[model samples]
Target: METNFAELVDAEFALEPGITYLNTASLGIGPQRAAAALHHGADAWTSGRSTFAEAEAAVDSVRRAYARLTNVPPDRVAVGSTVSAHVGLIAAALPEGAEVLIADDDFASLVTPFATRHDVKLRSVPLERLADAVRPGTDLVAVSAVQSVDGRTADLTALRHAAEAAGARVLLDATQAAGWLPLQADGFDYVVCGAYKWLLCPRGVSLLTVREGSEDGISPHFAGWYNADDIWADLYGPIPEGSLASSARRFDSAPSYLPYLGAARSLALVEELGIDAIRAHDVALAERFHAGLASLGLDAPSRGSAIVAVPGLGRLAAPLADAGIFVATRGGRLRAAFHLYNGTADVDRLLDAVAGRL
Candidate 1:
């Protein structure tokens, strides 16, 4: 009945009382329903009365839910425990002996997969150099919409065009940028992100969206029984030829059904809020967090649309924890992230905690 996009959004999620959680960037605290869903799923798995058919159905629900969220076909959205797992799949699928272009400031998780591959040559190009990085032989141009640490949003339009001109594919690691910007999966051949962050899902569930025609020639190295279209093949015979489903389902590697079910419930909640509303909500919260950090004389390096990074604020990390404020300090900065569920009280609590520590 909630038609208004603004009214449809609810910030009051079931979270622990007396704890100001501001680190949604690292790990999202799920709504009470997501936790409840996980409990029920575990109960089902443990109960001898339940069948594997039921569990598989739950996994399909997740695929459908995430497909709606990312605006891709359910068949194209593969489930993964971590973004790196899916990234490894992409790296393995790249044309043999083709160069993969990565950003100089991309997350290490995104970079490590390409760098470790012997067949793929990794070139860590600066954001400014991205336009020039694409060449005739380039296979993939991979970068995050926003730099994870510094919050630098790159020119996706330009990057997309550049890659297309060179007959290369584009991959976006939207782990940090998904909930903050308009995610256009049109230009990208592949897009992967973990759900625990802005999507407000529990950890261990990641989403990958591949454009309809983009995955035509790619083959998944991480295949399982579920990847086969005739999973219930008692009628058809054992692993029929060409039985593997098309789209992203072909990449499913017996994903943890329990976590996927939990993630599905959480993503359903995100759909109720709608991504555009979430983006506006998160950016506003980040602005408030940036202001709060400034008031406390702490410097937020790379304060962008999603995160507020306070460099050398590790000293404040423990103190803030002692004061009942939860945040993450990584890479030499105290990191505070906000989502739709966080409010001014949360921001003020963090500011006051830092002030008290000082």
Candidate 2:
């Protein structure tokens, strides 16, 4: 597996020489297969060889791929433009003055829609306490499966039990966890993920999976012709309600075609590698990084996550970026993430550089 991981970096990705990217948690490096799809699709469009049906085909392919990866039925997944837009449907459905429980530092896209609603009341807690914080009268619990800030993963099983006991619904944002983590989207009332970060697609692609019957009370306010039961016939309304899709497609945000075209191939790559393989590969690299940090007398959280954070080391972000080592700084921590394309060498390079500075 280690030998294969090293070969994959040169074969799959188009990263430049001297660049060591450890920021899959921020923006992923898409494989060449996916990049080629984008270029080819754009060229076809420019030459008038591409039809709208081709774009629809791309979206359908991606929808199916993501559903398979997350263990959900394809019809249960909703393709969309961004996480915020997908969450809007849920936020709009909340009754007046209902309380929503959320992790305080969760990505803004997951929190903003609900926070902006003056009619909804939000209670924020530390990620570790979020599940236990669920109480009676809490209408919903929203959280990330793997935290974006420092890769602290939520215990969704605990959260699920808490929500069930309280009669609240679960909204899981797997934006940072999806590609490398095993997920069963059926466990959550709704699952939302942005593709650019870990799923390795263009920025415009995102996904929302609705557990069957969970969306009945939610409005499909953003529904457009592309996701309508009949794209051509449903273009303009006084469109009968029957024109809406019989499943979660009714809640889909109109997809951006070219991105979905790229997404289809990138997602195929993920399936080819398989999540369990990717997770093993990624977590090993992270543990290697953690071990290296300990040898250097550096402090970091060791959560067995693909993403790692070095506390109070954010000053290194600028220097690392300058040295062609890409990473992110969040909450006074220097964040680094490992993926299937990374190996021990990348981890060692980061440690050597940090050792020099210290």
Candidate 3:
């Protein structure tokens, strides 16, 4: 696996000397291709050479690319600037006084949307017990495919079954799972993700895939000219009847085009490398870290995940950062996430740093 990605690391990433980046769960370091794309977009922007049509086409191309990657129709995928915005659409569509089942301690963006809805009764459960907790009255089951805190993964299959038995819909936040994990939105009623973390896109790019026939249910309260069939035509006037797209585009927020201009190249890199390969590479590095932690008599549950969270080590995050080993702290745990660009040396450096701090 190291041999497979040795050259890719050199070609894709441009980390500073003596730095070890193991925080892809927080923000992915984009490849040179994506960087180049961003620069090109910036040049076009400053030169006033880019047209609205070109920008719209580029954004839609990424939307279609995401749809194709997830095995869904392009019409079902909506582009947005944030997961909260996408989740807000789903929250708005729920019936009054509906019951929403969610995992406790989930990411704020995933939780706040449904929680903000005063009409819904939210049932909180542990991610591990989410499936068993679903009951007869659940109107919806919302969870993250990968928990942001401890790297625990949700059992989507079981959750789907439980939700189906309760006549409920399923929503999944794939922000932490999409790039290295093979993800398809067809299994759930709705899927929302921020692309900056795992998908290696710039900030301000998000994806929302609404299941077919869900278009009528969701009211796009945030809809703007960007969602119109002819965005240019609807730029000024009050949008007339039939102006908005009939599909999920009705939910597309006004885009930050420069980010989407660079997104396609990043997504294309994922397709070229294949997610399975990236997953293997990432999980291997994480497993190595877990073993190192165990050898040092630390609590390291072997979860077979790309992210490893070490209990009682949150205090070391600052020290590790100062030493050029970057990680995150969540739930009072030191979180280290491995990506395709990381290698065994990176893992060993982190373990060594932790050992020194101890």
Candidate 4:
């Protein structure tokens, strides 16, 4: 359960000395490369050296990076500012009275967008009952790839098969699972993620991937000039009718230049490190942490993913923070997430901090 790649990858992060960060699930530590790319983009924009073409190129890079990571075609990836915005668009595009199934424990971003829609009937079920809850009337199934609170990953293959059998589409929010886990585009009709979390980038940029041919079912309800096939021709010329881009770009939101630049760099770095290696390191660290928790008689909801949620440890968050270990508490559990930058030393620090308090 030792980590061999942590030191090499850890140097890329700007984490301070003597402090442990176990909250990648909440927000990833921004890498120096991403920061540099963001600063460079901002400088260019302020200096009037940045052109529309460069901005478009930056967005294209982000799309391509995410496409490569998810093994999807670049054209299938759409850009958004957050998972809620993109998923909200999908929810709005569904037929009126569409029945959408969601897990009660799923992140709010995955469930709220559809639940708030008056036209859509939302059904909430426990994670264990999701497959059973899917029926002929289910039009869509929405869930996070990894449960935010407990780091429990869904059986996507089983869920996708059931959804397909029931004529329902699957939408996955991959915010907590993308960088540390291997996410394929085939099992899901739509995959959305905010860049601030496991993507290791700044806020204000997200990836929304639409399966080919599935876009036809989703209306571009939030379409803007960015969705147009020819922005200049549609706006400046004769106001050409029906000028929307023919691909998933039709679902893209207006771009944020700096955030896109930073996201592109961060995603590129993730690719360079290789997702398999990152997952291996993360799982190893999580395994060690889980073992330590078990030895301390702590109850962990699940293991194997980057996150480990220990029940009854939520109250120790303040004490852990005082000890210079950062984690997240949700639903009365303390969530410790391991990333490429984490190692056994971090797990040891967390265990030590908790043992001392106990």
For each candidate, the alpha-carbon lDDT, in order, equals 0.75, 0.90, 0.87, 0.86
Q: Which scores greater on lDDT, model 2 or model 3?
A: 2
Better of 2 and 4 by TM-score: 2
lDDT score of residue 274 within candidate 1: 77
What lDDT score is found at residue 135 in candidate 3?
Answer: 91
Rank ordering of all candidates by lDDT, starting from the highest: 2, 3, 4, 1
Candidate 3: stretches off by over 4 Å? 1-5
Best by lDDT: 2
Q: Could you give candidate 1's per-residue lDDT for residues 1-358 as a string of tens digits?
A: 4336434344436566788888777877787677888888788768855567766776777778777766776777877778898888887777668798888868987888888788778888788788787999888888988777766677888888888899989889888866556677656898988777877676777778878888754666667676787666624445544777766777766677777767777777777777777777777778887877777665665544777777777677776777678888777778888787777788888887777677
Each prediction's TM-score versus the true structure: 0.89, 0.97, 0.96, 0.95
Provide the clash count, candidate 2: 0
Give lDDT tens digits, candidate 4, residues 89-141. 88888888999999888898888888788888999998878888899989999
Weakest 10 consecutive residues of candidate 4 by summed lDDT: 1-10
Winning model by TM-score: 2
Clashes of each: 2, 0, 0, 0
> 144-211 in candidate 2: lDDT tens per residue?
99988899899899999999999999999999999999999999899999999888999899999999
Pairs clashing in candidate 1? 75-248, 76-248
Model 1 quality (TM-score): 0.89
